[model samples]
Target chain A: MQHPVSEGVLQRPLEFTLDFFGVGEHHLRAMPLSSPTAVINAAAASTNRIKLSTAVTVLSTDDPIRVFQQLATASALAPGRIELVAGRGSSTITFPLFDYDERDYDMLYASKLALLMAVNTDESPTFDGPHRNRPLRDLTIVPRPEEPLKIWLGTGGSPNSVHRAAELGLPMFLGILGGTPEYWARYGHVYRDAWAQAGHPAEKADIAVAVHGFVAESGDRARATYLDYEHRMMADGAAELGRPVPARTDRAAALGAGGMVFVGDPNEIADRILHLHGLLGHTRQILQMDVGGMPQRDFLRGIELLGTKVLPQIRAELGTP
Target chain B: MQHPVSEGVLQRPLEFTLDFFGVGEHHLRAMPLSSPTAVINAAAASTNRIKLSTAVTVLSTDDPIRVFQQLATASALAPGRIELVAGRGSSTITFPLFDYDERDYDMLYASKLALLMAVNTDESPTFDGPHRNRPLRDLTIVPRPEEPLKIWLGTGGSPNSVHRAAELGLPMFLGILGGTPEYWARYGHVYRDAWAQAGHPAEKADIAVAVHGFVAESGDRARATYLDYEHRMMADGAAELGRPVPARTDRAAALGAGGMVFVGDPNEIADRILHLHGLLGHTRQILQMDVGGMPQRDFLRGIELLGTKVLPQIRAELGTP
Candidate 1:
């Protein structure tokens, strides 16, 4: 699946010290955004530093062995610089495509995740599960990376996903779209509680969230420009799902009232990011800006503004150098 | 599988136009050389321009979809600069590890190669081979590269391997590890005949060969040094196969009588390379020098000599830039 938009992003070089790098998902059928491993492999080559991440790589459909090996290969290029954000992704096309039942979602994810962890924990690995058609016996994943990878669970503020991450003692990445800052904050509490209940240390538990964001000369200017682009993408996405598009005007108003959409001047955008950091206490904050055929120059301008102004302001507010 | 020798080789930067690039096989358990794809991916990141290739990525045991995907991913980083030299590797470890029946070797390779070609040929492709457990419904391979990869069939001078390459209309890479240059030259003729018999044009047939070679200050010095290393490696290899090591004296004499091992001074090595090129009419010649824990500095020194001296001499004599 070759998506024109995917090529633009896959070819985008990480020119700065962006702590967490990520590629978005298009599920099984998205032409341009095929698998995250493909883009992440290219990302490994383009950037000397910065983590290789997936906003969400659907774990439910793909075989764990293949995913682990692929991620390990990407990480081998730059050990400790890759994170696989495993998720269901937004598209439902994978079930029929992979010959998987939709009802087996939880069991499949758990089984695959189990296999992945088993393979990683030993050089000569053996995995057998009902989900696997055949058992893998004494297999060694090649290109042994220098260190273990930090694979985060990507959740859409789903309770099960939050609890799964905590139960497994893995890091969590919350996709904070379509929600108020406080609305998603409850998941953070749930995740921490699950982690504590599961006997994992709070210090070791980590959370990261991604929210739609943009920065311009002024708050009004940023919102006005971003809203049109957001509405177009949302409408297209809704149509693809055979759902009626929610009224864009009402959606915009709701986002504006909640400060959920991080579209504003540098100061205002940074303030909301800080506000979320305070509300949810997320260890990392990723701003999803470029999407839905936004003009490359315009998207790049947003990136420049976000990096040069908003990021510095946020870092200063957080007392980080 | 991890071979200690490979790491030393993998770490070397391809600073010049040296012809046969490849990875040696160590099978599943060899701790050091796990798989060629892993090394090739690492090679992809480290080298620029010179073709990154696997000496033989075991095609029978690995998933064709995965192999194609891996190579495609590696090539996406350096489009048109990567070649996958698919081969039935020397190690027999993969058969049991991947649950492949030894009897199905030829059929497995054929079916997988067919699927790989099918996937490479179409954007949204579907393949349902009898050997494959399930039918694949129209699935698109990811990171569609800029150009179709030049996938060469690697053969150890086997007639079947040659016929398969010819029948498939693919280029052949002959791995001539032992025997005299003229002895190996016969396979080149066989391959050409097969290419013609298979209804492929003569001009379409291409061959490349790799041999054990070393470049030293002098012929006498090179032979004296190379023999000890060769004998040690040969003895270990024979032990692995439960066979007696060939007499070192006879082995040395056979190599000296013919232009097999190109271990000598730059002039001597260059002359032999040209001599074999004349005999086999091969378009490309690759020399593997490092073996049996040759000191990293010495191996690198051999590489330096081969590139700095032997290559320049060959190019000048060939009257090519």
Candidate 2:
């Protein structure tokens, strides 16, 4: 899953400078805010609390050492609040931009992930890899963060990805369009089983699922409002991934039990959340309310409904309140 | 002359993040915060006004297109408040890190600077340069800024450097250790002459000067407080560049007429500023108060003195509000 969040923060650190100047006073800015970590560093200056993470940093086409340094620097600014979710991004623009061949995706991701892990684990690492400029010896990355960061493996239903996360004992995050929660929940089980078989503690296995959805005051309103966006999204958005946009007549069935679309009012959405919880036992759930040129007012209303209505009901039903 | 001010800004975008956090209630932290542009991007979120710039981005070992994007992104965030001062940094570490040889420094800098200008000017560019991975064609950078940025050329004292800045028709900035103002002023004359010869408007030529200085209540106290730090800085910092630090006995003499060091009471420092202005005719002057690891309280005091006492006198003398 090319997480929209990670890409935004990674690519648009300079975006915040407007806030610094326009919003209030005494705001600081960074100069070269091109990379994600750099955005985090600049964020450190503007805020006191709030955990920062990349939704999914594309590991296949990036330099692991530099990536580690970037995250480490942010750690220095805001200790214990930095996390990284690594995956192959939704787009392939980075491959040619960074001078990498798309064919090497598998080997590149694995090798870069290994290097990132090594850099985090050891102060001085000596590695002979296809990507290294030279063998490093006892080299140290500076402005050392006060604490180690948590790394989450981001995947989009690839079986191989689940095994890789399990083998690494990394936390897992599933990103996708809304689909069969019951079947998708099985991927979590796969991760858990592999993690347990790999000798990791059973309790360490965790999963987070993010899907496209919206919350509204009424079930009908939610469906009607989201239908148009869903239609456009499925038609053009999924076209690149080879997923056919289904017939509009099937929308109702798709929102039923074990369906992909999650359009409904607070109660219906809460019920769906509970259903997914019961099936998958996911630790966290995220909803993407804005997509395919969503209007700002509708998006804001959806957010308000989710926060003030749906979430409270979900919490109470899940026995978490 | 790699202006120390630009170098400091380019290299330490991370340090400023602390200010963003510690000074306020609603702020954020970044993960990598490694690059100057990223810091600027994050800064955009926190502020609205105040021109942000890279003191010196070391263009020789960096990618100009990416650099332009970094600055451009900040421009989008902060609008007309973005500036770039480009220079070759004082360190040689980037040569090996970026896979460039020392021998190609001159050619690499010229080529890269030209590429940066091209990307800023045209939406699509095709080039066959020695450093490009491939010829770029019909590409558009995202978040196009509101206005063109102001780019300044930072130089220390190299004759060739002066000619390059003049030929490029970019504003010139002089960075130096305490040097004779009358002697140093000659570089400005040379730049103007070269700029005129290059057919640039005479009124467009501009110069800014920066040097080491400290302001206190008295000359004796200033000398006493800054001596040990100066002694250590000269000995260690000079050694890195293969120069010998001056003797302790020469401190007072160095602060006299035709001197580099600017240590004195606020009135005295103010007098020196006007003195340099008279000789060098610099439009702007920047003083470095903290260097060689001086205590924070002392550095803060020096800044306070510069603001409260030195600046008032200097402004009054110069007849500027």
Candidate 3:
């Protein structure tokens, strides 16, 4: 009789992706933001073990209590498998919807973020501030998780955001999709330096590099697939800016090739990740797989291959998990 | 051989108490606010299917996010088993702990409560405010139960609190434990009048009356037990207040005859409840079964007898569930 395999050994372990930075149609089209439940449940069901994250659940356009509540519930359901990368989201739709001005976005985020952190603590937190104020009410969030929930501020290369995160002693998740790998290195350096200057605890600051990636047997096939998606996304992004889509090859190539989209085989993809890691000293890297209506099957295959092949090699090369 | 029992007949039906209010030790002690989880869980597990409620959870003293998280989790575990009676809890502990002052408490509750309701909505909420602000963040609370979570503001005869709850379209659970039943009648009138003035849809305002109770076969036996517990509790309460304990009295006779404590047989208990209901227009009543460490067994027996005997009679008489 053939030997039976154990469930643990034979189970098809799917790779996990950061929930924050999925490159789906919603992210590219800038339509109404999609419900976070679908992606969150997908991560929970799959064997990916990846932290479900939101690259930046913009605080400016979002309610902090709501954000924390939703995220906290998701975290409870999944348990040690979620991260929140909070930022002032890019879309201007929130300003008009909430009757808020862009000028006050910074102050709004600062105050709300402070209140959010304070509220998440063990004690019933009361705060008096410009944006929000509560009196001496005894309150506490119920069903606090066993582990303290992790919150990362997703910064779009903003020094103030970086400094704020450091001052608050929260981890920084840099959005490196728009800039070069070298720029990430500089920002990472500034983040760490600021963190040090702020006299935070000795725990090493964690940095996560978020960028898009696609892989195939051949480089040409990967490039073609990436370009088809990139073109549409760039057009939509340009429309949001009320500017004509720039046709310049150099600009397009710079945007495409500057560590944002890694197109190649496993070895080549791993190499690009390593290069970015080297520059930023980032141990965590989020490869956004579903950019711009890329087929779900293709995305799954990429994640599968990354988990099966690329991640192991990258970890070995980096000497870390 | 015995015939097989039908599925419906064989099933042990679930039992429930229509409504009840619980006093948190935090407010009773006036120092070192107790953990909400401990208080809530203790009340939930210890009490029968009575609607377990915190007479008022001081929202200003604690973090609304944490409170909601805990309450949501508790509700999920119990399912129609928990009701949150939120208030600007009476105490100064929340201020120093959360670094908040008394002045900001009202706005804090207003903003946080708004955000709490917004987040629980189906659509992602966009909010802007001075104290607690969130932009148009696409988020949803996960593991939300099938039933609408019951949220009540514990208004201690405050028209503003009652008006706020009506304006927000939430229920108000009044705290009418301290004074005469006639006082509650005025408070109820004010709440209904404010509800009308708010011009919102007329939703039922749940006025829950919390009172102390004692029961025995003989009135004399009940009265003796009641006085012992009352005198001890009064002394303990006075000690906490840093005031001299009042000389003991036949308060058991006065309050019992005054129809505050239901200290008599099952018939008398039921009658007292009905009279209070008529006086205050309250449909729900929570008896403080365990008053100042009256024997646990006695407390359990008192509640058990009430559940099995007094409640059915009260229900039949009042035409309520």
Candidate 1 segments exceeding 4 Å error: A1-16, A24-35, A38-48, A60-63, A70-77, A92-106, A133-139, A227-250, A257-260, B1-14, B23-48, B73-77, B95-104, B225-254, B257-261
Interface RMSD of each: 5.3, 10.2, 15.9
- The TM-score ranking, best first, is 1, 2, 3
True contacts kept of each: 0.16, 0.17, 0.02
What TM-score fits each model? 0.84, 0.79, 0.55
Deviation from native of the Cα of residue A120 in model 2, angstroms? 3.5
- For all predictions, the C-alpha RMSD in Å is 4.5, 7.6, 10.6
TM-scores of chain A across candidates: 0.90, 0.79, 0.82
lDDT, model 1, position A17: 49
Worst 10 residues of 2 chain B by lDDT: B18-27
Cα lDDT of model 2 by residue, A1-321, tens digit:
111222243222233211110000000121112345544545554454555666567778766665666566556555677777778766565565545688888888887887777777765566656655455443443334566567778888789899999999888878766568767877778888999999999988888777778777777877776767767755663453355756665566666667866778878888888888888787777676765557756766766666677767777777874
Provide the clashing-pair count of each candidate structure.
Answer: 13, 53, 41
In candidate 2, which residue ranges exceed 4 Å CA deviation? A1-43, A121-124, A230-257, A317-321, B1-34, B46-48, B96-104, B230-254, B319-321
lDDT of 1 at A220: 88
Tens-digit lDDT track of model 2 for B233-314: 6566445434575565656556676687888888888888898888767777666666566765666667667667776777
Q: Where is model 2 chain A poorest over a 10-residue stretch in terms of lDDT? A: A19-28
Candidate 2 vs 3: which has more DockQ: 2
Regarding lDDT, does 1 or 2 come out ahead? 1
lDDT, candidate 1, A26-60, per-residue tens: 62222345556656655665466667786787888
Model no. 1, DockQ: 0.20
